[model samples]
Structures are given as C-alpha cells and as structure tokens.
Target: MTAVVNVFLKEGVLDPQGKAAHHALDSLGFAGVSDVRIGKQIIINLETEDRATAEAEVKEMCETLLANTVIEDYTIEIN
Candidate 1:
C-alpha cells in the first residue's frame, strides 16, 4: 500500500516562509501572484494488504509524530 500524508498550517496562522516565497516570485516579475502557502507532504509505502489497517496506522503516525495538532492539520490518503 502507498500512503500520502499532507500536513499544513491551520487557518489564521502566519506562514513566514510562504510569504517569503511569494515575495520572491513577485520580485522575479511573476504577475498576479497574490499569495502563497507552504506545507509538508510525506509519502510512505508499506507492505500492508488491508486498506483500513493501513489508514489506521497512517492516522496514528500523523497524530503521534507527523503533525503538531495545535498549529497544524493533516490528512491521509492510502492507495
């Protein structure tokens, strides 16, 4: 099974890195680039054959180590 985890800052949280990237784009003369947000993505491939089991394990991984719930949110997809 293949698992994809997407982690991103919660709404209303300031993302300085994203802002910097946006500024850089503007400086490069990319017009109409109004905003940018940065986030983290993790991909994992496992040997599990069960979809439900893989989802559960990936959720646990996100809650335990992949994301900071206080400032970020995460979602998982298994394929």
Candidate 2:
C-alpha cells in the first residue's frame, strides 16, 4: 500500500511562506494570481495490502504527528 498525504493551512489562518511566494510572483510579473496557499505532501509505502488499514494508519499518523490539527488540514490517499 501507498499513502499520499497533503497538509495545508486551514482557511482563515496566516501563511507567511505562501504570502512571500505570492509577493515574489507578483514582482516577477505573474499578475494572474490573487491568492496563494502553501502545502506539503508526504508519501509512505506500507507492507499492508488492505486499503482500509493503510488509510486508517495514515490518518492516525496525520492526527498524531504529521500535521498540526489546530491549524492544518490533511488528506490521505491510499493506493
């Protein structure tokens, strides 16, 4: 099994890195963008064959340490 996780700041939260990137884009004349959000992806390989178990384990990982539950939202995709 493989688990793909995407973690990003929740709406209404400040994303300084994203803001800086957006500003730099504007400075470079990429004028179509109005907002920016930054996120991270984590890919994990599992020995388990069951999709449900892989998903549950990844969810636990995210809730426990991979993400800040208070400020970030994470999605897990099992393949």
- For all predicted structures, in order, the TM-scores are 0.96, 0.96
Clashes of each: 0, 0
- Whole-model lDDT, model 1: 0.94
TM-score of 1: 0.96
- RMSD (Cα, Å) for all candidates, in order, is 0.7, 0.6
Q: Candidate 1, residue 2: CA error in Å? A: 0.5
Candidate 1 — worst ten consecutive residues by lDDT sum? 26-35
Worst 10 residues of 2 by lDDT: 50-59
Q: Write the residue-wise lDDT of candidate 2 on 1-79 in tens digits.
A: 8899999999999999999999999999999999989999999999999988888888999999999999999999888
Cα lDDT tens digits for candidate 1, 51-72: 9999999999999999999999
